[model samples]
Target: MQHLSVARPARAILLGSAGLLLSGCSLFQSSAPQAPLPASATLPDATISYTLTGQGSMPVVFQSDLGDGKDAWDSVLPLAEQQYRVLAYDRPGYGASRKTATPRDPCTIAAQQHAMLAQAGVKPPYVLVGHGMGGLYQYVYARLYPQEVAGLVLLDPTHPDHWRRMQSDAPTSAMAIKARRKLMFTSIETVEFDAQAQCLQHIDLKTPLRMPTMLLVRDKFGIEELGSVETLVRSQEKDWQRMTGAPAIERITGAGHYIQKDNPVIVNEAIKMVVKKK
Candidate 1:
């Protein structure tokens, strides 16, 4: 899930249910020099920074949460790699990659993922795994290329209705609207927070995913400032389950917003569910 709301620069603006909000995370405004990437972190041209590891017939593509790159999967990758290849990468503005001039809409983001796989010579029928806003992107990919996606695993994914539900859920609608407006230019990646909200409004959700799908939600979705919003959150989770035919969103105990980091067992288990479908 990604966030967009009033400017709370002190900490991440945690309003929208998109789940990109974090307490200590900083919103980067420029393409400042990032720490040197490991030599193994590879990508051709200016496509993106990614690491393709392991050797197997099928590939498990990993898409990280907003403002996060591949490192988010650092702990859980080995388990996934035991059976399949893994391709994890920075979207555009995060990690070692630079922000793209292209609009960060869902359609654009989906095409970018396809292009990245093509550039890497990684073929179709991929087991797509995404966290937070990344989940939305992978969902779009599955929609755009159903035959190519074997399965899907959504870890605390941003519900398609995240923005609209957020504005209505909070005590004041203005709070959530202001949050999106404030961060639009402050963080290069947050640009998509607005882009997604606007574009997703027009995207078709009537078509259900035919592939095996898994939806996992954190025990708590980190936005505590908005009082008594659990019901709203549950509604969002239910919508995801209904749309994608994902199982009920079980509340993962001992898991935070980053469920993959806090509990890799659940994440790997979900991945296994879809991979086994093959």
Candidate 2:
């Protein structure tokens, strides 16, 4: 396994409140537009939107983190598309996609993804790349249709055990819980969050991930800005260790939760490696 080296900057912590606001702003901000692709995949539920680019026998499918759209992967797509077909889609209620009445559980969301890909005529044997919460969806998809997945590259993914083990006393955890409660009655994100919470509750972490897998862990915990959610960080690390048969397990320094944005080369390289394995 090849490890990519990145330069770490001097440690300086942002105030917790300011960090949250800045992160939220960065996540929702529109990225500069890329040249439009000629074709887009529109599912029967016309609300789901997706774009497919590049060309190869085994396609690279990207799933973005929560509160983010397909555009989040734009910087990484150029090189990925150069060698293989890349498909990035906005999940329901994000980007060009509109809200759906369907339950947002992992199984339901995975099913929708399957239907969308099928409708769009994109065949399986996909190299799956997922970030943050998107990783859970990919894992569920692989479990539901094991034969369809060629490999997986999970970028600082959320562990199924996160919510359960998270220290409620921690400032970050408290903020998260508070936000979850507020969103529950006010926004669609709450519905999705609930679905993820439910899925995590029953997820069988012991199940083997048979496909070639690569897990990238961020080296910096950003404790200065986010308070010490030590338990949460440790839980994620434990989850990474559970991928016993994985081909690559890397600790990426100089990056945070949004590893792809901080270092697209690492993500793109991982995708390329997985594609070669297939």
Per-candidate TM equals 0.80, 0.83
- Of candidate 2, the 10-residue stretch with the lowest lDDT total is 16-25
Query: lDDT, candidate 1, residue 218?
Result: 58
Question: Would you list the C-alpha lDDT of every candidate in the order shown?
Answer: 0.69, 0.67
For lDDT, the strongest prediction is: 1
Off by over 4 Å in 2: 8-34, 38-46, 167-172, 180-186, 200-203, 224-228
Which ten residues in a row are the worst by lDDT in model 1? 1-10
lDDT of 2: 0.67
- Tens digits of per-residue lDDT for model 2, 1-278: 68865644323232111111112111212243345464445665546788887767878889876666788786677767776778899888888888877888887878888888887788988888887778778887887778999999887676665554554436665566556457533355567655675654455567678888878766655554344564456555666657425755687777666666666777777887777776
List candidate 1 stretches off by more than 4 Å.
Answer: 1-19, 23-46, 171-186, 223-228
Local accuracy of candidate 1 as per-residue lDDT tens digits, 106-151? 8788888888888778888899998888888898888878889999
Cα-lDDT of candidate 1: 0.69
